[model samples]
Target: MADLTDRGTEVGPGEFAPWPLLTMHLGGHPLDQAQLQQLLAWELANPERAAAWGITPANGPGQLQERLDWLQALAPRHGDLPLPPAPLEQCLPLYWQLWLPLALTLKQARDELNRPLIQGVLGVQGTGKTTLTLILQHLLEGMGYRAVGLSIDDLYKTYRDRQQLVQADPRLRWRGPPGTHDIDLGLTTLAHIRTAAAGEAVALPRFDKSLHGGQGDRSDPEWVRDVDILLFEGWFLGARPIDPSGFDRAPAPILTEADRQFARDMNAQLATYLPLWDCLDRLMVLCPADYRLSKQWRKAAEHQMKALGKDGMSDAIIDEFVDYFWRALHPELFIDSLKRDGEHVDLVVEIDRDRIPRAIYSPALAMI
Candidate 1:
């Protein structure tokens, strides 16, 4: 109920109230209202010292009065607005706080733009990769840099084509894995964006979670070229070719008897796509803390989908689907990718199994 404009300066309708300006010691935390008032009272009592500190009697009194008034107004509102349950706020901060360093590094890279740069973000399901990409887009735009987000999921070949692969091998439940996507379309789109041509538009496909197929009408196309940045993000964006020799030793639980055979067959077909990572300017892996955390995050993601009105996906279904890829989803493989390709991948922030920051990986430091 406090009005911001009553003190000579006019505030627009629905404008937020001005916050108080109270400075503490150079390296100290901000002063609370009581401390600020005590300081102001002490300063006013000693005019000679206040003047020596560059506080003129006329303006100093007015500024101190404004600070007192703003504090009085802020108190009631601060008490009225509900604070989040402490635990929720605690975990929530961990979600974004862990990524701040990586975000800062990426922002710095964007600032040093000499040529076009394409940044790819890699994560398994529910690792917040898409959300991170959206956050990056927002931050880049805030910094006066242009960024376009394109998900590999959006380039899945026609629904009809994907369905055939699933039908051909019932083991392939969802059309998300490597061979199921339209690699040709994805590569072509990336090439178009890279070359800086105008009038070239590529229609990106959209997935329909309710029907477990394409939405039929949701396709995003970039008509104009010369885009500064393209954020290509997906579950397996940086997945390397599974060395055939390692397949024999892969855990049996990771692949069912049928899935093991299917993976072997599919890997042969996916050989062509292995070189796609070479085209990336940089690869960023959002490595989960561990398999357990990854699974929990995946389940939480499924619940979020339900809240958003998506159907055909329940916790049970998510659990079952996750089981199929458990064997193939290796954090070690990702770690190796970061080690071998550290130069091409500017930064890797290793999150713990608890989703807390473990260490940061950079080419110069290797591990920080």
Candidate 2:
């Protein structure tokens, strides 16, 4: 075993201790004591590195070590405590790449999503909605706010129940749309979180997408969280009614004229949930540049599923499946409603057809 103390020397004034530098890089691995020492040593030798990270040298080695200890303690609780592959110096640029702009936007929108308010984020499939929810939870927690994420998908009806419905209708291929979920159960959970006694534990529903439905395992550890900020995100979260004429401009061709009529019919059916939007304190829309980009993201997600040793649909099949929903939902419903009712739609982050985010919407100037 390598002695961590022998690998690195401390530098900087006694008040600000330099972080260590490591020779052996652990890519995608958790930081061990040896690696941690090396990083400390590198920081000591290059004090300017600390400045770049916004880390002040005012805290001596002991304080720096204490910070590391705190992070280590937080790791297991968060699960899979993996460190960034790049060196601290190299990682700084990546942080600024996304975090800087998002930080500025977040600062402007922070009050809307943080503290005593319920934030609802809505987006179509493959919009990175879940990932953004997790990121928001992490960021909010870091800022000393207690935040939790709950999805409507979790409250899905049981597998057998949903299977029967799908088998009966055939049109209900996916159990993700509004009627497939248990709205009453979801509303109850949210009510509990909002009005329940402090420290109360409530059962939360869990969705098992691999099984195409949910399991009755109510004992999952995520249930009954005591949180200050609750973020509810899902597909069709803020979906509303739209005029039938909006479908005239859709680019994707249907099988026949009747198929086009069916698409318009489905949009009209979702009108029942328009009232749900009033429950949200704020709404943010993650608009991808185009359907093609959304399809690419779906492919990437399928690939990730395969990498995780899970069974997944092929790219072509996934694209076809997503297209069916987009053709029915996007042009006739979501896009038209957002464009028409600008007040309720707080922000629309423009994503290209390739699924790359180009710019964000500014309601003040009405530009992306």
Candidate 3:
């Protein structure tokens, strides 16, 4: 119901090119019959993708066509949507397949829970967690729900506090690892967003990673009210601690007693942050087919920065940066634990090296 323009300025039709929905659904409406045929033809060419998303050859066509028709009608309500910050067109082919299910999941939860919901999105660096959240926010808004996003990075302790950490232990200089975030701040913010009165405002904290020469620090606050849903995303959002025995033989490159000790310490630190995870009604993990892809993605990001004529981390620095995360907490082990035992993790969207969403696994929903 809201206009796409900044400050809610009214923009007449044709003021900006209406960004057409490449896929069938635009919000929730479907496409026309001719467009539906085109979409079906595209899907037919990608049978492997159809199977991956649980679309069978028999019922998939009709089912998809129905959803496409719904999206066509829903498009005008959102007006011309803005393009994403990154070049994610490669993944657009699977957009509706993923987005529609997620939208339904949230709507179902909202109808059942009868209150605002806080959903946690877990993904390693460069897996497009923020992009997915932003997309969901747009889709949810078009569905008449007010959604807001909060990053775990925004909860990092103040610059002064992190400097104290450096004094305490120089290895703690980098901020992504456990023990760097202010868990209380995240907990309180979620609580406010989940329960704030209609007129009550909530000030969300923000961190400026570009400040202090990339050491990063908290910046100003962003205030919002009437958030029907909260998307709290971070690389290690729902990570759990591994057993102490699992640290016996530290992974390679970690070949040191001190490194093993640091791993244990970080694992212990994860427990202190569990109360924050308790706030999530559901958790969605964006998993890569290969965990090592993060290294390549991070490197590519640095190269992109260099192309922009900005200071960027060198190859060696990038290696250390990516390795620090593994040393802090191995994503494979933590994510596997959550997948097997986490009560909150309801969806897992597997991503391939090409950044396309290959499949979605929903264990809880399947049981239902």
**Cα-based lDDT for every prediction:** 0.55, 0.56, 0.73
Q: Model 1: runs farther than 4 Å from truth?
A: 1-104, 107-113, 197-226, 255-257, 303-312, 327-344, 363-368
Question: Model 2 over residues 78-133: C-alpha lDDT tens digits?
Answer: 33212223333332221222223333334335465543456677777777677667
lDDT of 3 at 83: 44
The worst-scoring run of ten residues by lDDT in candidate 2 lies at: 1-10
- Residue 217, model 1: lDDT of 22
> Candidate 3: which stretches are off by over 4 Å?
1-66, 74-92, 364-368
Cα RMSD to the true fold for all candidates:
13.5, 10.9, 8.2
The sequence of per-residue lDDT tens digits that candidate 3 reaches over residues 1-368 is 01112221223775421124453244444456666555566555655445434555576667675455435544454333344332223333444557654765676577788888888999998888887787778777877888889999999999999999879988896888889999999989988888889979999999999898777889989999888888899999988787888778766545688778888899999998899998889888887878888888888888989999998989899899888888888766677666555356777877777666666666454444
Clashes of 1: 3
Better of 2 and 3 by lDDT: 3
In terms of lDDT, model 1 sits at 0.55
Best by lDDT: 3
Clashes per model (N, Cα, C within 3 A)? 3, 29, 14
Worst ten-residue run, lDDT, model 1?
A: 1-10
Write candidate 1's Cα lDDT for 1-368 as tens digits: 01111131234796432222222222234556565555566554644334323345456555455434433333333322223233222222232223222444455565586544678887776666776676566545544666778887777766677667778877665666667677777777777677664544544345544354332323445454446677888877766666665556565454556555655655565566666666687787776656456677767756777888886467777777776565444445434555446455655555554444444445433432
Cand. 3 Cα-lDDT: 0.73
